[model samples]
Target: MSTPVYEKVALLGLGLIAGSIAWACRRDDVAGEIRGYARSAESRDKTRKLGFCDVVCDSAVEAVQDADLVVLAVPVGAMGPLAREIAPHLKPGCTVTDVGSVKRTVIEEVAPHIPEGVHFVPAHPMAGTEHSGPDAGFASLYDNRWCLIVPTPGTPEADVARLEAFWHRLGANTERMEADHHDLVCAVVSHIPHLIAYTMVGVADDLSKVSEKEVIKFSAAGFRDFTRIAASDPTMWRDVFLTNKEATIEMLGRFTEELFALQRAIRTGDGEQLHAYFTRTRAIRRGIL
Candidate 1:
């Protein structure tokens, strides 16, 4: 058997992402020991019972104590305070990383709290499901998914490489990206899509012409997929949009322009334009396949 990527890995949140990380790390022997902590006693209890963590601590500070790699897997808005709380407790040479999708905001929030000798490398695992909580995690959640690593300036190359190696051990493909570019790319690909999904679901909910029962009873595959995306953990998504406002709004504006063009095509019965537009989009889907 190969050596673990981290001797001690600490996860500061017990939600889906963190739980899945623990599960994946254990599955691949990525870490020699996994310790976890959640804000709520109930989540701590659940994590303890789940047994994915070798030791489940009640506090973030305790969990990060002497940990070689500490992962802040909480919502973006919560990372700052959590970083401050655990800063003094992190070992001098240990590395601290986060799984928040909004990279620029998270770097702004969590970077100052990092100690002089410690490394701060932010990463986002581009993988998850609509379900959340400890029960929602599985060992294969991150398999073959991209995990973007955003290395802060002045962070040593060795430290960044170590974090990339750790994620690879968790079965994720790793790539280094600039923080601003990371947020913008994620906004275009993830944040805006989720926002649109939530909006569509809300429109259906408020469409009094269609009864809620009917909406649920006759959900097409498209609408059902929208519902799935919109069903993601509300707190997490809320933090994502709020922290990633600039990029999200920019993308939303572009999406609005495209929507308007489609509306015009439909109203004027421009079948040729519509066909051309859909054919281009169909190529995108085929490329993804």
Candidate 2:
């Protein structure tokens, strides 16, 4: 067989991202051996049965031993503790990375625990489904997606490039970004949109005139899409909002301003203003397409 990206890779959580990474590595022949660990016994058992991991260890320490690359796939709130747990056991020259949504807070919390020799490169894979768990991951989840590699200052270029190459082999296009900039960009592109979706779903639920049955029975595409976004894992999103508070709040304030303008246009029967606004927004959507 040809050379793999890493001889031994360790996955620190058995959630959707981690499981998907393991399966992608297997599919691409990216790693010679994949070791996995999860705090939940059920998740560990499920991963073992899934056969994505060559070995599922009982502890994080065991899983990361001698690993050339270690991926922390836990929730953002849990990443710091997991990093501390695996720090001492990390192999020198190994690359440690995480798949958290927010980068600044993750770098702040997890960077200190990385030993002097181990390289801590924080990353966020811009790919996931509303579904989460060991069974929710597939090899193609990251295909054609962007994976931002937010390496800390002074980290060797070789290390960052190696990670970028690894992600490339996993079918993701990689881009290097700074921690703070990454957080701000994610806030605008992902965080605020999810927040809006949750709020819209909640508003529908709270409308007494519309019964839940009717809401579900006559759900339009807009509402259905909102429900899909709002159905994301609560704990992960909670951590994302909390950890990325400043950037999220800044963007949210801007969002509120735009919302008030739209509300005002509707109240005043300003069809021209509404049409102009929608036309511009539609162009933005077309750009995305």
Model 1, 1-289: lDDT tens per residue?
6799899999998989999999988887899999999998999999989999999997888899889999999889999999999998989999999999899999999999998999999999999899889888999988899999999999999999999998888899998899889989999889999999999999999997999999889999989976688989999999999999999999999999999999999999999999999999999989984
TM-score of each: 0.98, 0.98
What lDDT is obtained when candidate 1 is compared to the true structure? 0.92
lDDT of each: 0.92, 0.92
Question: Poorest 10 consecutive residues of model 2 by lDDT?
Answer: 221-230
Could you tell me the TM-score of candidate 2? 0.98
lDDT score, candidate 1, position 93: 90
**Candidate 2 accuracy as lDDT:** 0.92
| lDDT per residue as tens, model 2, 140-168 | 98999999999898799899899998899
Model 1 spans > 4 angstroms off: none
Report the lDDT of model 2 for residue 226.
Answer: 63
